[model samples]
Target: MKRITVSLLLFLFLVTCSQSDIRHNQDLEDTTYSIVEDKNESVIRLSSLTTFDWEKAFLFSPYSPQEMIEEQLDVDFKDPSDLDMRDDIYLLVFLNKGKVVQYAEIERQDADFSIEGNLTPSNDGINIERY
Candidate 1:
């Protein structure tokens, strides 16, 4: 009877461990796929822009220095009347014809920025088809 009980306990432990491992792996795969999907979408949208440049595309906080932003885009930060200085992160993009686009709700960690699961065409960027 003791032998049978020990074997049963061991089997249960092994089963539980395997199940946990499966769940962990599944979570990792999902996260990886989500990152990849975001990256691919960003590439597609950026490629559609007629005057997109890698050097000019960057992340900035609302509190970032005005000089930094103005220098990067080579445009004056005129503080447009329609612009609201919301406390949030943004992606500054420069386009042809002296157009500038700002994508909001960007995620920032120290100096790193991530758009994963945050991009929406209507809110974050223009429709690729129209651009």
Candidate 2:
């Protein structure tokens, strides 16, 4: 009887741990945003910034000849989606509840660049979609 009880408790503990891990992964997925490329244009897309407590959004282009940085974008996504991606490469950063959640690296090629996917920012970076 003692061995059976111990085994049952162990199984419950394992199940609890696994459930917690699953929840954590789901949370990450929920917070992800995406950027996509369509013929001659790149669109910044997200589910809903306010849903994740997103506080800030910004875009910076390091390769541009002139300093171009867009700050304090609409958290509710009222801002324009077609950003002026004049440089070959760019970085899009998003703050979720005062923490950096995105480091999306975007690249544009002539007019042929194609992009699509979940643009959610993570430590590994947000996925950029090209079309």
Candidate 3:
């Protein structure tokens, strides 16, 4: 009975290890952007803007701007217009065919900040940089 229990535990361990390995491999294969950390900030670069979801990347990120603002300033922004009025912000640089098209500077003080831009392909490609 002890031998059987040991064998069952070993089987479960192998299964868990294999599942973790599969997930790690899938994440490496599915990653579309690269993140670089520099001192106090991180830079996210995307080869194509079409695949970039700003709302998901920023507003819903692990360290969301909204949560940061609320924690630091004790203020909340409910409207899009309110974000534009703030001073403490981060920048999103947009490119079309590797050329700069538009940019947005999002204030960290705002609870809900949205990025607006023309993501359509004007030349042959699209790229984005978020810092």
Candidate 4:
């Protein structure tokens, strides 16, 4: 009986933990933002940024030129089926010399404001996308 109870408890714990999807976006305060990709061309320098909380890019950024960074992040959410289901993702990105370029949320169902602090700041030219 003791062993059976213990197994049941362990199984319940794992099942509960794995089903979470960061829905209703109460995890914004626990966000993990990172600065990714910076580069210098003889003609122009470029940089990018993105955010991640518990799931989804919130802001999925790909390395692009400094000028085109904003243009690129026009995230193509083909089917935002879960838009109203729960947590909306938010992301902020900047370019060279602390240039604020993009700051927006995706699929969030709450009115949570972004937490402005450096979870990770760029030193040289780094491109980070959360895993």
Best by TM-score: 2
Candidate 1, residue 8: lDDT = 100
> What lDDT score is found at residue 54 in candidate 1?
29
Q: After superposition, how far is residue 102 of candidate 3 from its true place, in Å?
A: 0.1
Relative to the true structure, candidate 3 reaches a TM of 0.21
The CA lDDT of each predicted structure is 0.39, 0.39, 0.33, 0.31
Question: lDDT per residue, candidate 1, 24-125, as tens digits?
Answer: 123322432344345334323433332222223334545666666667557544332112354433434433334344322332222233443423332233
Report the lDDT of model 2 for residue 57. Answer: 46
Instruction: Give per-model TM-scores.
Output: 0.32, 0.33, 0.21, 0.20
Candidate 2 regions with alpha-carbon error over 4 angstroms: 1-37, 40-42, 48-53, 64-87, 111-131
The 10-residue segment of model 1 with minimum total lDDT is: 122-131
Number of the candidate with higher lDDT, 2 or 4: 2
lDDT by residue (tens digit), candidate 4, 12-98: 876555333223232322232211112221111112222432111223322223334334434221212222233444333332223
Better of 1 and 3 by lDDT: 1
Candidate 1, position 79, lDDT? 30
TM-score of 1: 0.32
- Candidate 4: what lDDT? 0.31
**Top lDDT: which candidate number?**
2
Pairs with steric clashes in candidate 4: 24-87, 36-126, 36-127, 36-128, 37-126, 37-127, 88-107, 88-108
- Model 3, 42: alpha-carbon shift in Å? 19
